[model samples]
Target: MRRREVLGSLSGAGALFGLPAASAQGKAPPLPDAALAERDPERYWARVRDEQFLLPGWRAFLNTGSLGVAPR
Candidate 1:
């Protein structure tokens, strides 16, 4: 099949499966409150790590330099 035909089929299949289109997906969760950070530093950082970043829960990403992964 042609590239366009393949893409069209995939798009239709995505719709049939009830997948959300790019624009339809809602915004990311808001950043945790500053007060939470001050009151409970561990809990605050956990929220930030879990909500802000897209890394898998099983993985540990510790490189925050120029080559670090950006937040999703």
Candidate 2:
């Protein structure tokens, strides 16, 4: 669907669901960096299982519309 159409639908659904306005959306929790693994297997899994998955490049991390990660 087109951007405007999709947004319009979301707005209608939001109202029907009694959700807050679009601007009142909740923020994604911060993700721990891959660098924090300290070169260990345990710490690596810690980030993978907990950190928010973000695509590489730009502010893809801030986009709530995406939940999958593309290879960096």
Candidate 3:
């Protein structure tokens, strides 16, 4: 993605920072593509990380860590 497009997409991220916990939970809103891509709290990281960097399942995780994490 181009830098401008990326910057525009992330333009509202700071809004969350200003919101109180209740307000943040009050409404569910649509997500931009970037946010959608990372909604996977399931540790959907690459199947391989830095070590082998090419192994089939080197970076996969069961993602049982974050209780509040979202689904892919």
Candidate 4:
């Protein structure tokens, strides 16, 4: 897999969709790199996991091959 695909998974899909709105509205602060894995790795990861879009019925992890390159 490509580096962005991996980082996107690590950062959360919500970051892609939600960040623009948050930036336009100036509501949320940017997360430091360490913040993603520092304080509580499990909790942070759980939140990131929740923010992604799953394949039609699969439980977790994006199936990029099925979805194609548009979203990527």
Candidate 5:
């Protein structure tokens, strides 16, 4: 199966196992403003990383195995 499909299925399984889905964590931040991206690409990407993903800020995750890290 494709990577995205695998991750999606895993996320569903997480829900079945009583983990919170992304939406349940909180409301997602608004889409980064296009003008901000145009004006400051680095800042825009930082915003994307900080707001759009659930990765923790305290650690680096660098798994390169077949499954890699789960989506969130």
Candidate 6:
């Protein structure tokens, strides 16, 4: 495909997947670390996880296979 067509296809796919545009490009915003640490760690993390924008029509994932790695 041409460049424009490829870009359009990728953009559409991102929207269809329910991924926030920025996060879909691997630019996930940092969560508030201090606040999270002060609260119950497990409960705070569960709230953060619940806020993630996952693929459309999906409920939950049992593993990390679909998640991206942090930049080094």
Best by TM-score: 1
lDDT values for all models: 0.83, 0.60, 0.46, 0.57, 0.75, 0.62
Model 5 TM-score relative to the real fold? 0.43
Indicate the worst ten consecutive residues by lDDT in candidate 6.
Answer: 50-59
Candidate 1 lDDT, 26-58, residue by residue in tens: 567899999999999999988888898787777
Give lDDT tens digits, candidate 5, residues 1-72: 999999999999888876556458866668799999999999997787677766666656577466553343
Q: Candidate 5: how large is its RMSD?
A: 11.1
lDDT per residue for candidate 3 within 1-72, as digits (tens), equals 999988876776656665687575655433334443477633333321322233344345455576533332
- Residue 35 displacement (Å), model 2: 0.8
Question: What TM-score should be assigned to candidate 6?
Answer: 0.32
Q: After superposition, how far is residue 50 of candidate 5 from its true place, in Å?
A: 0.2
Count of clashing pairs, candidate 5: 0
Candidate 1: count of backbone clashes, pairs at least 3 residues apart or interchain? 0
Q: What TM-score would you give candidate 1 relative to the actual structure?
A: 0.51
Which model, 3 or 5, shows the larger lDDT? 5
- Using Cα atoms with residue i matched to residue i, what is each candidate's TM-score against the true structure? 0.51, 0.29, 0.22, 0.29, 0.43, 0.32
lDDT of 4 by residue, 1-72 (tens): 999999889789767888889767743333335676888898765554444322332455455578542210
Residue runs of model 5 more than 4 Å from their true location after superposition = 1-27, 57-72
Scored by lDDT, the top model is 1
Candidate 2, residues 1-72, lDDT tens digits: the string is: 899999999999878777655435755666566576666768775466445444433443444477555322
Candidate 3's C-alpha runs over 4 A off are 21-72
lDDT value for model 2: 0.60
In model 4, the worst 10-residue window by lDDT is 49-58
lDDT of predicted model 4: 0.57
